[model samples]
Target: MEPTGSERGPARYEPGEGCVTTVVRVPVRIVVLVLVVPVRLVWDVLTAAGRVVNRTALRPLGRGLAWLWQTLIVRPLVWLWHTLVVAPLRWLWRTLVVAPAAWLWRWVLVPAGRGFGAAVVWLVRYLVVVPAQWLRTYVLAPLGRGLAWLARGLGAVLGALVRWIVVVPAVALWRWVLAPAGRALAAVVTVLVRETGAALGHCWRAAGIISRALGRCLAAVLRWTLVEPVRWVYRTVLTPVGHVIRDGLWRPVRQALRTARETVRQTRREIRRALFGAPREPEPARAVVPRREPGGSGTRTLGKTSGRDVPPPARG
Candidate 1:
């Protein structure tokens, strides 16, 4: 159909004016189906990936990081901080607290030590050394000197007393006793000499008297005994014989003497005659001279004729 001009002009369905148009209407359910389903599927995939990362890789990484921080990083950092910072704080506290206390004690205690040492030295000097020195000076030295003086004085007094009392008396007594003995000896010797001289004088006189008496008595006894007896015998026996001899022999001798005298005269006459040649003449007889014996006064005649005058010799 080839339709002619103007009518054909616009194969249009006109509702009101001269324009040709087509109007299409969409469904709500179809829109929802396309957009909502794609968005939900993408969100689910993303969520599952996040869970795997956390479980397989991210969780282990987080634990290793925590261990490293505690052991290597965090603990070393804490030790370094204490060494560098906290140690100085503790030293400061000690210096502040203890140093002041020690200084105060030294300042207060030194004076007390010095005071105690000085007190000990003073006590030793006063109690021991001073007292010993005082005793030596005041007590011991004076006592020694006093004792020595007393001993010397006593010795001198004793010596003087012994010499005066004992020695003098002994010497005087000896002299007195010897004087008496000497006087007595002189008296005894004088008495003995007088007695001996008297006795010798008496003995000599007695001897002389006894010798004279003995001589007189001896002579008297000899005359009475031996001499008297011999005289008596001679008187008794020889007196008569002597008288006879004297008478007989003398008568003859007297005759012969007369004859001889006559003859001698005759012979003288003959001799004278012969010589003269003449007869001799006889001469006359001459007178004889008589002898005398000596007497007290003068010579006395001794003859028979004088017998009467002589008083006849005493018979003996």
Candidate 2:
């Protein structure tokens, strides 16, 4: 067996590899190599040429195009926008719109708005605010007070009626009738609950006792009727019959079957050999050679090292 890990080489044989693989690999490799060399050379040459063209011609042309666009197109467009559109728009706004608006606001609208606002203030004070204040003081205040006094009187009467008619009767009924009835009901429920629990517990225990007795009877019946009879039949009758069958009948039958099987197999093997000849023995595997190290033999010892200054010691 060979060592594995890094010592193993990649040239190991696959189990599926056969004469077909051996025959195909050399021709395929040779054809592929022949076809690939020219394609690879052309690809390399094209790649180098593309790099040179991009570096020498395309880069400079792109830079020139960008500069021309900025200088001739972008700068002129910006200049024309400022000169033709922005400057004229600025002047027109100051002359036609801004000046006229400013003058209208300062000269006409401000004074008119001031006078109108003063008139509006005077009219509102006399028409809306004064009337509202007078109404609140004279009419609404007295009416609200009269309605409040009436409501207070009605509330006092209603409160007395509710106390006598509803609250007192309800309180008396709860204290005298409902409270005692509730207490009696609670007591009845408590007695019923305790009795129910006790009855259930007694029933469960009696049932358990009956169940245990019944289980014992059933187990005894089964043991006598089924288990013991089955045991006796197996031991006295079936056991002997099985032994006799095995010794006198089954063993011989099995031996004959085994012999017949072996004979059939032998006959088949002989037929195969007669038709196809005996199978060839596999060739022994060749020994694997260990790989040689690149650095040759490593770490030479002092005993093996030779000295140039000293004469050789003669062997006796």
Candidate 3:
């Protein structure tokens, strides 16, 4: 048995079997990979070595360059900006712009406005308010009072003129024309009546028989017309009614008024006593004055029995 196919495998060797060498055929790309793997590994190792050298050796050499850039170049530029540019600009703005404006407002504008306001106030007081007050007090008030007085005088004069011209004339006209004429007519009627009465009296005396009858008839008519009813009403109605009111109604009212008056007086006295402690007692009557004797200089007092003048009873 020449080496079977299974024995051709490297791990598949049998006992007493002949050694068989087998060749595996590979592609060109795999063969090239076989050839390039060691070179690629060596290249990677060389790059790693370069990175270590750069970390240890080259990074330290560049640090001085970075320190020089920050110290010498950047610090000087920042210092110049702060000292030369920023500080001067800030000072210029404060000194030239803000300070001048504030100074002008504080010193010039504020004082000018204050003075202008004071001037306006002064002008208003002297020109407007003072003049107005002066005019009202000194001129207008006096003028108004004078005008009122003149108007009052004019009204009084007008009233007097109207009274004298119109009222007096009307009263005179009534007195002169109407009143005297009325009086004259009334006197003429009175004279005519008296003359007629005298003529009737003479006729009555002359026709004595007829006069007696007519006189009796006229007197009876006059009594009936004017006197009898009046007398009867007075005696039977008015007098009795008056007596009844006086006795029944008016007497009680008068009595009640008297009682009320007494009550009021009593109440008043009680109130007066309550408020003022007590009513004062009336003063004693004064003594009568002694008469002066004729031809005597002093007064003489009358005595009880003697009828002689007593030396003016010792003055109380």
Candidate 4:
């Protein structure tokens, strides 16, 4: 049979159905249908009656009541508000507040602010800027020049004294006594450094040979005592044991865990289905509506214009 509006969706899936559900479902469905038929019929009758009464009586009555409210109560209230409250408030704001504020800002505050700003500018220029300029130009400039001239003279004198007293004596001492001593010491040091370098090279080569032999002996001992045995044990014993445990014990435990998890999940789903109904299917997507161009009322003529084209009346 073709499905009705109420039965248009896909059928609900039953998971692992058994004997008890099959026996109970048909009889329960029959009893429910029988009990529901009269209630459904009564609901449909009442719904139709309500629609008829609303169309015939209530809609007109509501419209009449709305019109009465708009005419009697709303119109009078709006008029009273405009006359008693809004107009007086507007006049009071314009007269008492706006006029006084405008007069104060224009005649008193603006002029006073301008005068005070001018006075401050004049005071700053005279008391601060002019005096600072004068000091910089006359007093500080002359003082800096005199100090620079004195410093030049002192620097020249000090430079002459330093060159004669310290530089000359030091140069003489280095040239006469220290130069000969340093030359002799350099020659001795050069000979000693050459011999020392040769000896160090021989020692380094001998040490390298000794260290290579020692490293080889240690490596052989470690290979025999630790490395080879550890490698053999890991390869011969640990690898096979690990493989046995993985195959014989771990894999079965993992499989049992996975099966238990799946069983618990299925049980939870069944319990939820028993408590609530099946989850609803998603609604079908609505068809997209194409955009429509604005429609014209009629074809335009040469002399006639649309009402919208007329200019609004000018406000006074």
lDDT of 3 by residue, 155-220 (tens): 999999999999999999998999999987776666556445534433333344333355579899
lDDT for each residue of candidate 2 in 1-316, tens digit (9 for 90 to 100): 4433432322444577545445545554455445544554555557779999999999999999999999999999999999999999999999999999999999999999999999999999999999999999999999999999999999999999999999999999999999999998786666556445533444444443444456679899999999999999999999999999999999999999999999999999999999999999999999998865544454335655436445898999
TM-score of each: 0.27, 0.33, 0.24, 0.28
Q: Is candidate 1 or candidate 2 better by TM-score?
A: 2
- After aligning candidate 4 to the native by TM-score, how far in Å is the CA of 64 from where it should be? 0.5
Q: Best-fitting candidate, measured by TM-score?
A: 2
Q: On TM-score, who's better, 2 or 3?
A: 2
lDDT of 4 by residue, 237-304 (tens): 99999999999999999999999999999999999999997999999999998764545564356787
- Which pairs in model 3 have colliding backbones? none
Q: Which 10-residue span in candidate 3 carries the lowest summed lDDT?
A: 17-26
TM-score ranking of the models: 2, 4, 1, 3
- Which structure is stronger by TM-score: 3 or 4? 4
lDDT of each: 0.67, 0.78, 0.73, 0.79
Candidate 1, residues 277-298: lDDT per residue as tens digits? 7865899999998776566344
